[model samples]
Target: MEGTIKKLGQTEIYRGSRVHLVTETIQFPNGKRAEWELIQHPGAAAVIPVDADGKIIMVRQYRNATDGWTLEIPAGCLDHPGEDPLECACRELEEETGHQAKKMDFLYKFYSSIGICDEIIHIYVARDLVKTEQSLDEDEFVTVEHHSLDALLEMCFQGVIMDNKTISALLAYRYKYKL
Candidate 1:
């Protein structure tokens, strides 16, 4: 179990601001050799901010990868290696939605794309929100919106909320709060 797979070698194919692509040569436990195209990621944190009125704060922003707008929870990548995921969630919540959380409870973590990427996103439920000024990146243009938890869940089922992190986080929150 300890050394099931051995990395024989790896070649960096591309390096970008958020991710890097690499081709890895791996030796499996049964002596099978294979080449895997892996997308290296720094990880991220996502927050479902629930305010006093039982509404979840969300953001609608244009995603270049999809060439369209997406409704998603506040999320951001780890600013640097080893950064605390909870802190990142809190920062992203305020920066994206102009809301500061007094309490942040961890829900779960998952890989966004298990087949080709190693991007682990830590999800949390942020409660007791306080209003603040949003601090978005220079290129970020987001519209903050609040929706009922049930509505968000319906959106998830209706395929309106396509962001994996948002859908997962909303389901987790619903289970945790029985909403």
Candidate 2:
């Protein structure tokens, strides 16, 4: 379906460390034209780390976007453009949770916002983990916690888990493991 649209041009709106904003003009298959505001991102990766005891490692961090602390799976943006998301997931899991997994598997990838943003977040499942020291970014303040899958499902049911990527990743984990 995307092949039906032809890009006309794009006007730069803003550029930042993480994202670039632009208004893109396009001509539809029907000859209609429109302008759409798009957010260009370098993408990101997240991991659901499960330990030997079957507890999932999670992170508690403050998000200015929500004006509060959020409980989410360990995640981080790609180091730079053209970086491997799998490597980002592996790096973020250890950096945030202080645990490195011996068995890491790809779960899925998703668009953060379909309408306006081009951010893609790759999700993974990490098991057989061994504890290491957490290496956080200067701007990051994260507290690592562990939870049972049942407890995480309850958090989602009660709306406590609000991050979309975390929610979807949890659901996928449940489906994958038949839990």
Number of the predicted model whose TM-score against the real structure is largest: 2
Instruction: Compose the digit string of candidate 1's lDDT tens values, residues 1-179.
Output: 55588999999999999999999999989898999999999999999888898888899999998899999999999998899999899999989999898899999999999999999999999888889999999999999998998898898899898888888888887787787
After aligning candidate 1 to the native by TM-score, how far in Å is the CA of 10 from where it should be?
A: 0.6
What digit string (tens of lDDT, one per residue) describes model 2 on residues 87-153? 9999999899898989999999999999999999999999999999999999999998899989998
Error of 1 at 140 (Å): 0.4
Per-candidate Cα lDDT values, in order, are 0.92, 0.94
Poorest lDDT segment (10 consecutive residues) of candidate 2 = 1-10
TM-score of each: 0.95, 0.97
